[model samples]
Target: MQTGNLLLLLLVMIAGAYYLGHRRALILARPLGGIRHLHSLPFYFAMRSAIWSALPALLVLASWLAFENSIIRAVVVGGMAESAQPADPAAMNLVISQIQNVASGAIPASFVSQDVAQAAEQLSRLQNLSGMAMTVVVLVLAMLGSAWAWLQVSPRMRARQKVERVLQTIFMVCATLAILTTVGIVMSVLFESMQFFSKIPVTEFLFGLQWSPQTALRADQVAAQGAFGAIPLFVGTLLISAIALLVAVPVGLMSAIYLAEYAPARVRSFAKPALEVLAGVPTVVYGFFAALTVAPFIRNLGESVGLSVDSESALAAGLVMGVMIIPFVSSLADDVITAVPQALRDGSLGLGATRSETIKKVVFPAALPGIMGGILLAASRAIGETMIVVMAAGLAANLTINPLESVTTITVQIVTLLTGDQEFDSAKTLAAFALGLMLFITTLVMNMVALHIVKKYREQYD
Candidate 1:
């Protein structure tokens, strides 16, 4: 059955079970002089019945959806004879894609071989049969589970305990799945990075002075052994990020302080939303602003002053990125600043401190951790920005501290290397994974450090 249809059926069954359970609970309690004889309330009994009806059927539907695609593909491919089968898994996937396209009417039947046409027909029939079977199985399980729970619903039944345990189990499963997903991502990237390291020495990738990655396909080709030095990309990433933080931190923090603390209620209501609108503007739109407007303006301004500025300069990209992340810093800082106890501000003002002095001494100190967190978030956002950097800063990986020069970052290089059809064994493609690993580790370490700082210095103003 379609996932949506199965969900609808489950919901209906749960509703029906709830009504029956409520009625049954009232009937069971009536002989014993009202619901006081019941172990728990009517609501808990109904909820227990509903949970029983929904959980088993939902599990069946989820299991079916998860394995449906792979099972169908295997069955369709297995039906072909050994001589007619694909040579490799990759070719088999391609053949499967064509069959799917044909089956879905994206490709005409005459466009494929008769064998493939027959396989597509077989695939459709199996899918139909599977759907019908799944519908029957799920519905039956829902009805059976509800019936069993209904019969078991007596005055002594621990309906509250059973319902709470089910919910707790569901929550635990969700949390475990999230942790597992993160670990899985880290392990996958680590494995791919090891493959990359096998091709290129760790030292060369980490500390070497050059950044060429174009490996020649033939011995006679020019620039045969590509340089894999990543110093330039790292340097460029740091330089642009530093520029962005410089622009974002002071402005966003000051604006946040003003809006949250000093602005009148009417002004605060309108101004905060207006300022946050910058965050809502798409990054691509900011990229165009950087490329078509900011970069050219910077270049022309430099030329008029008899200075050299690349048309696509890091300064332009960084400025635009800083602008993009302003709301990150401002909104977070505003929230934290506002959360500071009003008593602290009152205490400072009672000591004859001015409003500005009270803010700097009492409010700012109390909210320091949260402000630092906001700055860290903005820094991460700046480092990870790609579209603005790609459009405003040219792709040349120059290891220069000067913001006027064109440069590229790790993210930009990763995108460049892995843009087209890639061979897993090549250094160029594997380098993307290595870059990803470094980026992940860098961000992870930064988060740990920020959390440590926050924990170490945070004060309870209350």
Candidate 2:
């Protein structure tokens, strides 16, 4: 049976089990005087039955699916003659791919050797047998589990406790999975970065002034050793992010203040959603606006003032990025400012403070931590922005701090480095991972600082 069909069948079985368990619970409760006398409610009994019928079946199904391909492939390969068997891992992979293609009709049996054609047939037969076996096994397990749970159901059964424990365990497992995923990502990046640093010195990658990742992958190919300096990328990222923050912070904060504090209900209702709509617009659209409209305007305006402005200047990218991130800042700031205790505001005013003074001294300080968090989020968003930088700020990797000059960021460089078919063994491809690690560190530091500020002020307020 197909996996989806099996899942649907399992759901039906679980529902039927639930109904049986509930009916039995009610019957037992009637003999015991009432459901109030039972250890748990009928609802918990039903849910316990459903959990029993579903959990074991799902676990078996998942395990079967996880190893089904490898098991079938091994059986098929082992059936082949010794001379026809693959000699290396790469060769085995290639043979497996060919067999799969033939089985799927992407490649005709006549196009491959007789051994491969035979293996494809064997693979198909084993897969069908495995599916049938899996269906039987999963259904039997579900039926047994359901019967056992139904038999155990009684007026005194602690069904609620069992169900709650299962749910708590599931939640713990999910949290562990999340932490493991983050650890896996960090370790992968760290390993690849180590490989990169083995080729290029850490000092050169960090403090040196040039950024060039183009080099030959094979020893026979002629190319530059490639300047691996990342200082230029860091400068570009900071310059653009700083510009974006300068524009976003002031405008978004004022907008939030007006909407949260000054605006009437009707005005806030209409304006808040409209302001936040900018966040939903795709970054690529912002990139196009920057490249086509804002960049040209900046260039023309700069020429009129007799100043040099590159066609793809950091200023153009930063301005458009700032506009794009305005909604992020505004929405977050508005929520935090609105969340400030009304009592604080009332107390400030009761002390004969004017509205402006109350907001400046009382409301602002109370909301400062949250406001700082929003700005950190916005700055992070700005630093990680790739499309706008690529479109508006050309990939020149210039080390100058001038906003009018063309420059590139770490993200843009990472994308450029790993764009097409790349040999991971080469420094060029590994540089992408090194850049990723740097970006991750920068974001982590920003989060740490923001969290510190939040923790320090939150205690005072609480």
Against the true structure, whose TM-score is highest? 2
Clashing residue pairs found in predicted model 1: none
Query: Per-model C-alpha lDDT, please?
Result: 0.91, 0.94
Instruction: For candidate 2, give the lDDT of residue 85.
Output: 94
Candidate 1 residues lying further than 4 Å off, grouped into runs, are: 15-38, 216-223, 459-462
Could you tally the backbone clashes for each prediction?
0, 0
Deviation from native of the Cα of residue 330 in model 2, angstroms: 1.8
Model 1 scores a C-alpha lDDT of 0.91
* TM-scores, all models, native as reference: 0.92, 0.94
Model 1 lDDT tens row, 1-462: 676877787889999999999999999999999999999898889998888898898898889889988998899999977776899889888889888988888999899988888889988888889999999999999999999889989999888998999999999999999999999999999999999899899999999889989886555767567888999999999999999988889999999999988899999999999999999999999999999999999999999999999989999999999999999999999999999888888999999999999988889988989998998999899889888889999799898989999999999999999898877778888899999999998899989999987887684443
- TM match of model 1 to true structure: 0.92
